[model samples]
Target chain A: MIVAEQKPFAEIAGFVADCNKILVAGCLGCVAVCLAGGEKETEILAAALRMHRRLQGKPLETVTYTATRQCDPEYVDAMADLVKDVDAVVSLACGVGVQYIAERYPDKWVVPALNTRFAGGSVAQGVWEERCGLCGECILHKTGGICPIIRCSKSLLNGPCGGSQYGKCEISKDVPCAWQLIYDRMKALGRLEWLLEYQPPKDWSKSRDGGPRKAVREDATI
Target chain B: MNLTTESRLEKLLKRGEFVVTAEIGPPQHASAHEIVHHARLLKGYVDATNITDCQTAVVRLSSFAAAVHILREGLEPIMQMTCRDRNRIAMQSDLLGAYSLGIRNLLCLTGDHQSFGNHPTAKNVHDLDSIQLINMVKRMRDDRVFACGEPIKEHEPRFFIGAAANPFADPFEFRVVRLEKKINAGAQFIQTQCIFDLERFSRFMEMVVERGLHERAYILAGLTPIKSIGAARYMQKNVPGMIVPEELVQRLRKAKDDGKNVADEGVDICVEFINKVRKIKGVAGVHIMAIAWEEIVPTIVQKAGLYPRPKAD
Candidate 1:
């Protein structure tokens, strides 16, 4: 999931400071799942902007619409009829969706209303935490399902370093040592021998270290 | 007569009969027709109509506006204000605005978390919890000044502030303590979360009596009729801290099996629940939350034998 948090109200106001006719776009994809850019949230932001603009004696003509998914050309094309009259479009989707809107509507300026954060699930009722780094690698089979790459502060692959104490990380007493959890899980599963095997260093080229990635199949193309 | 806050609460308590109250949900859209309709339905039958502000975190017409509409329709309104959307500054300003509009009764709540509501991206400003909001109202009533040291030259608001409690939400022992804390924070009355299990309510009332808070404030039990078997199941699983007893569910199921009208059976369940609550010694009244079924409130009140009695001093 591409998690994002809505920018502060003041910052949003500043972004649309010049535009009189603004289209506040919302995405019903990953951003909606995280409660960042859903239909309801789009309306609220529009209301707040209207109220703030009224208070400042600078009225604005704001229209809100939520595309099924902002990342796809079909969904972004659906909003073309609504975007004609607007001076600028404020995209409330993730970075990819924002870029897609900008690419599709090259004439109109597109502003991002959310800061895309890492992919994660809600830890508790109202809390969200990062879980994956999207490094384009899967090493869980060797680490007993615990990803030391993301969970460990140093992202150490070998084992627990001298910084680990009493199952806790040296960086913070509250943080559980990721390698310790990995060791305990492997020991329980009789897979402790996997840790002793010398593994090659991760290839960073497949990740963001290289340029933007794309996937295509010649047989599937029309 | 400009009655003091104390005098108003005292007058309600001294009357001693069941004080009926009804809820008014503010509209999400700009239209006030729905709010006015509910207010008109409950005008004379209820003592006060509660205007809920952005209930469950969805944006709605301001409670202050709803209260004004209620007052215009010649009914007292209990403005339900939650500390979810605004900071202390805005809350204080809105309170003064509500007072200026002649709204006297206030129900303070630490609103439902924004995650549960439709607007997930909306930032929640829990500047002050419910207890602190109650205290702020009390301060404004007494000193006629806000936390920011702003003086009110206008007539001071004599607000009969109320709070909410969920006896079924917490352990039995903690319910009493929570009620006591609310009372200490200057809550003149309390409307509990929906009550399905009367036996538990009786035990809760017993605890209130043990703490000597039964006499200090009016405790209004909340009761909502279960419209269908699906609704009964939904309440048990989804609604936090709500316990719909097996007997009531079984009764509704039986009603369904008999091929009788389900809504009428739901009303019968509500009537029975109200009667059970009335027999409990410490329950001052019952707040019937018939969600979107405002038309049936009068019927429920009439069935519960809670017609507006002559105020006895």
Candidate 2:
């Protein structure tokens, strides 16, 4: 899931500094699960922005709405009328949602409220660790189902680079060595031969080496 | 044919000479006096001096800007670039810009995490890891194209590529293999993480020699002097990826207890390390990172007998 965090309240207020009317748009997709741009967060941010503006002697009006999923065009279209009325919108979604709302409502000034982080899942409550590297290619099946691309600091196609000590990455003690996890998991499954089976340098063309990627399934297309 | 000529460091490495290199950390503020002073101090004593790109992830003057300033001082600069701050787009453009300004050597690094820096809340853009970045730079120089395979009409940046290796970092067995990969990815030279553990560093170098990687690429031993017991303790407990031997820390503590100047002992120890590491098989040179204690660099160089570097033709 794509993880993100809300931008600072001061920065949000500055984006619509001159305007009196503001719309706080949230996404109830991955961001909702991450607790970054959900409905509750959207309302809290709207209230905070109002408070900040009032303190600055410029009282502002705010409207809060959480779309089912801002990434979807149908869901984004639901907010078209409300978006047209607001002086500016502070999108509480990942980069995709902010652009989607902006594309749908070209006349309205749209600014992102959340800074989109990595693509990962929650490691614990309130802590989301990056999982998949979003590399176009998937090599999980071979590496004991662990994604080294995202976990390893060097992202070596082979096993872990030299900095793997005591199951921790060289960059920090907090991060577990992805290769060690792979080695341990493979050892448990009696599949250490995968380590011997050398994986060549990653063919990055499958990743973001090309321009923006696309997925057009024939059946899903019109 | 190789898309460019050799750099000063490249020529020295090609000749199998014992190279000595130091680091110049740009000050956070924009006053060029500190940088210029460092450039002058490092000018004739080493093959090349590395200007760190936001060393320790703290924002500072651009390494590229400092490198150009170093160049003006009649010294060679190894411009360090990290993946932490830029995406592929910025990386390519910056490399081109640095080259256009006459910077020749480039060090690719996966910089320290942003959380470690002053701007902890800033979002990191690791558009390319160090290995990918090395390959991309190699492609730009040799293949005459960017990572996206787009051709450059003129002035492709032909750099003498360098990378960092931390043998003290973990999974000791894998260190040699990582160095091999860096060499394969077009690293002509490598400056290792600071060396406080000679036994472990030897084992790491032994593996590099076993794979004949040292023959393929220039491997420089990294040395950072322990100025005080407190400083040593801080590195032992705090510095990530650095492994400072307990014995060294004890020595510093002992010196402090004796009321002797611990800084001199640190330099004494560093000079010995330089002398010892220079004799190690496949270890071509030493990269001294006396970080903030730049004043002691010339003394260490003189004591280690590495002063008066050979003129590169």
Candidate 3:
């Protein structure tokens, strides 16, 4: 799922400071699962903004609503009436959602309340870790299921870049070296030879470098 | 006769000579004056000096421009490029730019994370990691084509590629395998992270020798003379991927209590490590990273008897 965290209350507050009435938008898809821009987060931000405005003797009127998914135009269009009724829209979703909202209502002042982090999973209760870089090409089949694109600090194709001690990254004790994890896992599977295959330079054209990419299925077009 | 012998540093390593390279950190503020001064200080003492690209991820004068300054002073520069600040487009363009400026030796690194330095909030563009970068450079040189297979007909950058290694970093057994991969990716020479744990480094190098990697690439041991006992302690406790053994800290502390200059003791330690490391099989040279104290580098190189670097005719 897409992981994200709310921007500081003050920053989010500043985004809508000039507006007296605004819509605090939320998403029920990836952000909701990650607990970032979910329904709860939307209300929390709405309340925080209201209190902040109240303290300044300028109370704010916020209408909080969550769409099934903000990345989809149809779901985003559902918020059209709510968006038009308010002075601005505070998107409590991933970057994709914020942009989608802006695209749907071109004139509506839309802003992001959360910083989209990465494609990751919940490692523990209330904690999330990044696991995928969204690199168009996925090599997980050969890497022993470890994604170096996101897990390795350097995103090295052949790594554990001399900074792996005790299976941890050299960057910090909190982060485990992705290559070390892969090596150990591959060793366990007796497929260590998979690492010796000399992965070539990544074809970044399939990645963000190729500019905004889109996927299409001819058979599913209908 | 490797086509890359065009660079003096590469030639030195190819001849099996103990090459010495130093790091020249460009000043944060705009001024090439300090950079030129350091180049002069290191000119005769080291075979080539590296101009770091925002070493530690702090913003600085771009290393491509800094290498031009070093080259202007008639000193060969090992231009450093980090993935943190550039995407593949800028990276490839900068390589051509730096090479056109007369910089030959190249060091590719996956730079320190932005959080490790100032401007922590800045977005990083690590579009290409170090290993892939080495592979890309090799492609550009040998294939004489861009990464996308577009051919380049003019001023192809013939570089002696280099990469970094850290023997003390975890999964110690895998460090050698990583080094081999970097070489396979087209790194001709390597400079390790600072070496304070000799026993551990010896074991790492033993693995390199066992694989006959030393025969393929020049391996330069990284040596950074501790400025003080406090600095040593900080590195031991705080520096990521660095391990300052307990004995070195005790020795530095003892020197301090004895009222001996810690900086001098630091140099002694550097010399001692160089002497010991020089004897290790597969070890080719020492890369002196006298970071802020660049003035001490000439003295350190001299003390290590690497002064009067071999001249490439």
The number of the candidate with the highest DockQ is 3
- Per-residue alpha-carbon lDDT of candidate 3 for residues B260-285, written as tens digits (9 for 90 to 100): 99999999999999999999999999
Which CAPRI tier for candidate 1? incorrect
Measured by TM-score, how close is model 1 to the native structure?
0.59
How well is each residue in A56-135 modelled by candidate 2, as lDDT tens digits? Answer: 89999999999999999999999987787789999999999999999998888999999999999998999998999889
Q: Write the per-residue lDDT of candidate 3 for residues A1-222, one digit (tens) a residue.
A: 899998888898888889999999999998999888889989988998898899999999999999999999999988878888899999989999999999989888999999999888998999998888889999999899999888887787876665567778767888888888998999899997777667776888898877999999999988
iRMS per model, in Å, is 21.7, 4.1, 2.0
Stretches of candidate 1 exceeding 4 Å from the true structure: A1-222, B1-3, B6-10, B149-154, B309-313
Residue ranges of candidate 2 with Cα displaced over 4 Å: A1-130, A133-136, A141-144, A152-165, A170-172, A183-216, A220-222, B1-4, B152-154
Best by TM-score: 3
**Residue A40 displacement (Å), model 2:** 13
Query: How does each model score on lDDT?
Result: 0.79, 0.86, 0.87
**Residue-by-residue lDDT tens digits, candidate 1, B32-95:** 8988888888866777777888877788899999889988987778889887787677988888
Candidate 2 scores an fnat of: 0.25
Could you estimate the TM-score for every candidate? 0.59, 0.75, 0.89
In terms of lDDT, which candidate is strongest? Answer: 3
What lDDT does candidate 3 reach at residue A31?
A: 92
| lDDT, ranked from best to worst | 3, 2, 1
Q: Between the candidate structures 1 and 3, which one is better when assessed by TM-score?
A: 3
